[model samples]
Target: MSRVTLAQWQMLAAVVEHGGFSRAAEAVHKSPSTLNHAVHKLEEQLGVAVLEPVGRQVRLTEAGELLLRRARQLLENADALEDVASRLAEGLEAEIVLAIDQIFPPDALARSLDAFSEAFPHVRVQLHETVLHGGVEMLEDGQVDLLVSGLSARGFLGEPLVTVRFIAVAHPEHALHRLDRELDLRDLEQHRQLVVRDSAQRQSLDSGWLKAEQRWTVSHLDTSIGMLERNLGFAWVPETRIRPALEAGRLKPLPLTAGGVREIPLQIIHRDQDRAGPATRAMAEQLRTSVAACAGTRNFENIE
Candidate 1:
């Protein structure tokens, strides 16, 4: 194994970054002679000249440029390792369990998860895509560390996150849109209404159901959207989830004179905020920030 140390690479990088050993030493709180010796020793150990003096400044040699480029990755990994260790010392959760309702904005959810992965790379994540009371059940049973839902738990309070608007829509060829005028609840009851099944085993909800004579229940939102796109039924879907379909004319709004659009205010709930670990709290923060950042891009609004 090579005897070169991370400190040696760091000193070499500092010398290159600060133009010379003297400035690098001042920046790193080290003596100029010490920084100079570290770089010299690193070059000697590697048997490669890592720096070339030019007038009063120093620059990396060609070989040094290539080596340092790879070394930077190593330095970053080492820094991340230390950060993980520090978080673990502060009681970071080994794994975070998150339950989010399916109606939540897909783009915002993805952005939150992407940011969470960057901040806690080593922490495992368990994401449960739920519907209606499904996430509430997990929060009530202590199965999830965090919950993002439109419904509220009995005891646990939730901070308002975003308001998701639902639009009554169906395929362009569906009977509902063929009416070609402002529809009403009476007209919808005659058609098949697609409904996403509530995932809670014990206490489920029939949210957004219009009590149509012909009702089809599916397990997931995607399934309902698939059926809606195929002219199988009409249902109210979140605007964010079906924006592309609406924009592309794959789906047409029911054009109801009233209740054509509905809104659900979702909130971020913590299992135990006081005892939540750093990773869990960070995940929650990312979710909030992600939704806030998406407000400008998407049609959703923050629940003030």
Candidate 2:
């Protein structure tokens, strides 16, 4: 079929919404006659009767319904394209959609956001907190502009940016605190390891010790923290995630084996189809810098 005319699509969409040519035409500032003629032209082009007059208002025929759906999509896409082009011409400024993993600290989030706002004051930024099963694929699909995902089993073709550490943590009053800073696997195994439920992102833990003990299994990272507080079980949580607690003497680090260590590397991921928009690229770089600042640069060598 021939491509839809912009005028006809506009007339069709307007009529569908307004239920009358006179109203639609007035809304679009076109003469009622002109709008009526445009719809007729569309019907002739499609070789189908498009509009059917109801008792007082008008409704779409089968072809009209289909055309209306397609017309709305086309007009929406056109508007998006036009806006992108306009933003590009003015400067590297457009609405940015960024996704961040929930593990990152909310306070640190402000610093990265501040940098973006200061750099691109004109551009709008929308931030979403994505946990596992989050919008990481959205970045790959171009539904999201950028994502702040940590290293995982699969590669996103992203650059090696930041490195994180997993530490053996327990409540201060727990039996493990009597030991030194250097943690051994035996001590970790002695206590039940409170693992977070449904969080596959941190599945790289070496739980040989826990399996030996056959201890209790709990859910929720925070709940695990609570369990640790109540001397329920020992947990190996991300160092970056529980750093404050460890420092405040609320939680104590029990020495664990270096071999069981795991590192989470943060990266910027974008789609092949997406031409990295300026706003997106800028924010992605800022995230890279922020993540690196929190954790050191990727130390893949240390990871076993």
Candidate 3:
């Protein structure tokens, strides 16, 4: 079998992208005959007809389409390789993938990302907003460079970023709020509880006082909050997220006799601190600073 060259793949990809060999040649700064011959040689080497002539323009055959898809991926990988090499040569990171838990304060996350953008304009950031164990899973699976989550990841030390207070809340006119005396477990169990399902694939877990007889499970924290706002059910939502609603009389904390507010400790976990690049370390520092700026009395701790 003849080995296919990258130059041939590039010519084929260019032809498909520009809709014809002539246009591709013009775009890539090559003559039309050169691109045409390159694609023809590629087809001969692969022992298949890659392009078919229509009325005016040419189209990719079935085999051509399959090869084109793989060719595009290869070209992208090659580009990424070059980008990484260039960044490394310049002592900078090409990209940073960050996975953050949904419970993390939005203002803090936004502030951190804003700082990151300003600090490292050339570095590309891939943000993944996860829930529950999703962030930890991403960290463990090597899918993210850094993780900010409430769940503690095994085999990795984490630094406490902030403490999120979860308040059991419901609409002002909800039955739970209309109760005469302080609410208890029995009262909550009678009402429908809106719970956010853990976004873990392997071992999904539930959290925060889910003892309700009737429960409405959702995928996102916003969905659960929306349900609470509509008086459809009660949920334990982050205090920061419901502050405006609480002040506006749209949502009120359930006056539970025992447990009303639950404080969750969130932490920043990295797969390997030593292996992290300069951009990753800088972004981590920015995230810590952002959380500290918002955290009033919450103390930051490092697990080592």
Which numbered prediction scores highest in lDDT against the true structure? 1
Q: lDDT: which is higher, 1 or 2?
A: 1
Q: Residue by residue across 1-304, what tens digits does model 1's lDDT show?
A: 7688999889888989999988999999999999889988988988999899999999999999999999999999999899878888889888999999999898889999999998788999999999988999999999999999999899998999988888899999988777788898899899999999999999988887888999999999999999998899999989888888988999988889899888899999999999999889999999999888888884554222
Which candidate comes out best when scored by TM-score? Answer: 1
Query: Which 10-residue window in model 2 sums to the lowest lDDT?
Result: 295-304
Pitting candidate 2 against candidate 3, the one with the higher lDDT is 3
TM-score for each of the candidates: 0.79, 0.52, 0.69
Q: In angstroms, what RMSD does candidate 2 have relative to the true structure?
A: 11.5
Cα lDDT tens digits for candidate 3, 1-304: 4388888899988888888988999999999999999998898888999899887789999999998998889888888778767868877887999998888888788889999888776689999888888888888899998999888999999988888888888999999878857988888889898888888888788786467899888998888888888999998888888888887899998888778878888899888899888899999999988887766622222211
Total colliding residue pairs, candidate 2: 4
Candidates in order: C-alpha RMSD to true structure? 3.6, 11.5, 9.7
The candidate with the higher lDDT, 1 or 3, is 1
* Runs of candidate 3 exceeding 4 Å displacement: 1-87, 296-304
Per model, state how many residue pairs clash.
0, 4, 0
